[model samples]
Target: MALKTSCPCCGKPFSAPEDYAGKKVNCPKCDHRFVLKTREQALQEAADLEAEKLRQLEDRRRIELIEREERKHRDRRASMPYYEKFQTGTRPVRNYDPRSGPGFLNLRYLADLLLIGAYAVLMLALAGLGLTVYLKFAGVISSIVILSIVLIGWILVGGVLFLLLKYLAELALLMASLGDQQNDVVRLLLDLRDNTDVDSPEQG
Candidate 1:
């Protein structure tokens, strides 16, 4: 009679002679050598293997659920706006660098120009006042009214001329710098226009 046998390693079925039962046999499929077990022992081993497979499947299912939840959290974060996704503490701080890139003249220079121009205008005004006083004491001007008018006019004209010259110099410098970086200036102008449009409300 033929004995029914199955490989323990690969579970491949094969037929052997009755004398082969309970003897060491090498599995044809897996090449694993083992003593053949009786029907009862084989059934029990298969049951144990099925239980281990179920446990492994449950562990794999648990891992997959955790990974799916993590993926969902990542997707939610990715959907958020840039500002909302990151904390303020993690944001990089930037300091204003005066010499960062090529652009218009420094504002400090314009301030210096204003200060120097104002000082010069004040000195000229003081000189004019002194001259008017000297003329009054010397009897060159007959009326105090005429002296006052002359002094006032001198200071006003001198201050205006200084301011005009300063503005013209600043404008010339600005134009030259803008001409040199024409592309960058154009981009800056476009950005300014866009910002202005965004800020302004549309009229019905």
Candidate 2:
């Protein structure tokens, strides 16, 4: 049919006649640059765009149909008793408890490894200090004093690091435990409400 084009910058519409094909021109309204297309090429492009829109509409319709089916299935399952819900095996029970947090991947493991590494490093430091002091002083009374000082420093630093790490690890575990307990209480409350609602209908 006829050629139709819009300004690339201002999006103003314009018609391209047969003489304007393959010509470069500025839009009259916005003075923006755009190339005019041949009538046949413009028609083909329009067809392609219309085909793309139809395909998208079909895809959306298919998705909506699938979602509607799923909703219907969920309603059917809601009508079924709890024990019979999984009897068909079509829908498996997926009880993923988030409060348990990532299974084996957690901070406690890293904390334990850090504690072990810190212990080994401190022990090595103590050994190195004793060796250096013994070599430099060579069994003098000053050597005993230096070794005592080194031992005391080692004890103080090591104790602080160890206790800090111990507290941190225990605190992490305690926090996780408290979170799980809170979730358990919420879940129990929900179950209690559900049971009361379900039983009230029967009792009435």
Candidate 3:
């Protein structure tokens, strides 16, 4: 006797022997091949497959939402006025070009490092010279007093120099990052210009 079953590939009803279980067969509509299974096993497999499909759809929807938010941010940046964009540090407003040299050879950053290093060397040299001169010319108590004053002045100078260097270094880093982003934007624009069809503006 022939048993009735639906072809998994084409969804067409057909009759086959019960002994056909676990045997490969081809569907008539789509010509897809699959192994035969009991009705209960097929039902369970279908349920699991549908659940997986729904999970993948939900993941794709979440990714689309994230991409939309990023696009909005880029559009907002592109729409800002020149002055406002410059003030916000989003514009490429640097006086020096960063792409011409190695990381340490960038002139602006090098200048800041030199200023900090000069201050440090000067402070150390002055402290050492003053302490030695005082100890030689005066008593230990007098030398100690003079050295204390020198140390305090050194600290004040160091603190001021540090603050200035820190500000300049931060500005340099911000300019470098902004310049890189601007370069990327320009490259993307160039690619669009080259690839887009001029005859059909609406397609772009």
lDDT digits (tens) for residues 63-88 of candidate 3: 99999999998899777754344342
lDDT of 2 by residue, 80-135 (tens): 74324534222222332223453333655765676676677667767766775666
Give per-candidate clash totals.
0, 0, 0
Which parts of model 3 are misplaced by more than 4 Å? Answer: 1-147, 200-204
Best to worst by lDDT, what's the order?
1, 2, 3
lDDT of prediction 2: 0.67
Instruction: Superpose all Cα atoms of candidate 3 onto the true structure and report the RMSD in Å to 1 decimal.
Output: 15.5
In what order do the candidates fall by TM-score, top score first? 2, 3, 1
- Could you tell me how far off, in angstroms, the CA of residue 45 lies in candidate 1 after the best superposition? 1.5
C-alpha lDDT of residue 86 in model 2: 33
RMSD for all candidates, in order, please: 23.5, 12.6, 15.5
- CA lDDT of 134 in candidate 3? 69
Q: All models: lDDT?
A: 0.69, 0.67, 0.65
Q: For every model shown, what is its TM-score relative to the native structure?
A: 0.33, 0.41, 0.36
Give me the candidate number with maximum TM-score. Answer: 2
Candidate that beats the other on TM-score, 2 or 3, i.e. the better one: 2
* Poorest 10 consecutive residues by lDDT, candidate 1: 88-97
Better of 1 and 3 by TM-score: 3
Indicate the TM-score of model 3: 0.36
